[model samples]
Target: MKRNILAFMAVMLMLCMSAQTSQAQLKRFSIGPYVEAGFPTGDFSTTHNPGFGVGLGADVKLIAGLTAVGSVGFDYFKGKTIDNGNTKIASAKVIPVRLGLRYQLISILYVKVEGGTANFTGDYNNGTGALVAPGLGIRLLGLDVEGKYEAWFKDGTHGFFGLKAGYNF
Candidate 1:
């Protein structure tokens, strides 16, 4: 997990340097900090368990209607038991570093392909691995809404749908 985080940071630094060179010609480059509350929905042992998460990201408009996004986020899942009562399965802290290509479908709507590595911590028996998530987004009234299905090759697959309300600045 530590190594993955380091790698992600390194990549982010490189991207930032590149962006700096092109900043003069870019239309807009903005950063937004967001918080998200959602649950993990999957067929794994733990389902319908609620969790809260937060993230910070930057969006760099590379073209007129296209942008390059990089984000790092974390989530904590209070696991569930097989029976009715709740059990302490495990709490996961996920750091997802994604590089996405965004296309403005309309004036206030956009879709993105989110592919990144999810460095996880906690007692998730399936093991920690990377994930490739494809998602969509919409920008309206200074708020951005996004939903994506994440697939972990080893740490179990889950769908994460999030609604983020943040100012793009």
Candidate 2:
């Protein structure tokens, strides 16, 4: 009886091991392309118009429902010259390298917080400043959509509202 039980248990274990799917392999890393829109607020709105950007990023799973993310992106903004509200638009470019943490709250919902440095180069330059944002992420139709409030610690500017959407692999 003991030999028969042992044989049955061994067979079951082997069957379970073979039944493992490709999901585990795919879940290890996810890379995608993203698009973002920015809505400036407070002094920011007064000094800069709305903006849009596009980039690509990747996320690596750290633990259960946790991921480490790194991304580089570019943004374009129309800076409304400090002297006066000018109709002539001076284009400002921002290139940001960001690293952050994302925690899954549920099957389709997640919360993410990130901080990094953005290089402000081009016509209207304000040097470089630290960037911080807290966001909510949702997975739908094979895409991840996020809404965030971005805070910029700089000389003269406030934060902005950001909308992001991306497809994951």
Residue 144's lDDT within candidate 1 is 83
Query: Who wins the lDDT comparison?
Result: 2
* Every candidate's CA RMSD: 3.0, 14.1
Residue 146 error, candidate 1, Å: 1.8
Candidate 1: where is the Cα deviation over 4 Å? 3-7, 10-27, 45-48, 84-87, 140-142
Q: What is the model-wide C-alpha lDDT for candidate 1?
A: 0.67
- State how far residue 86 of model 2 sits from its true place (Å): 5.6
What's the residue-level lDDT of 37 in candidate 1? 68
Q: Residue 29 in candidate 2 has what lDDT?
A: 62
Tens digits of per-residue lDDT for model 1, 64-162: 788887777886666666565645555555666677888898998888776777766656643466677676778875578776656555545755555
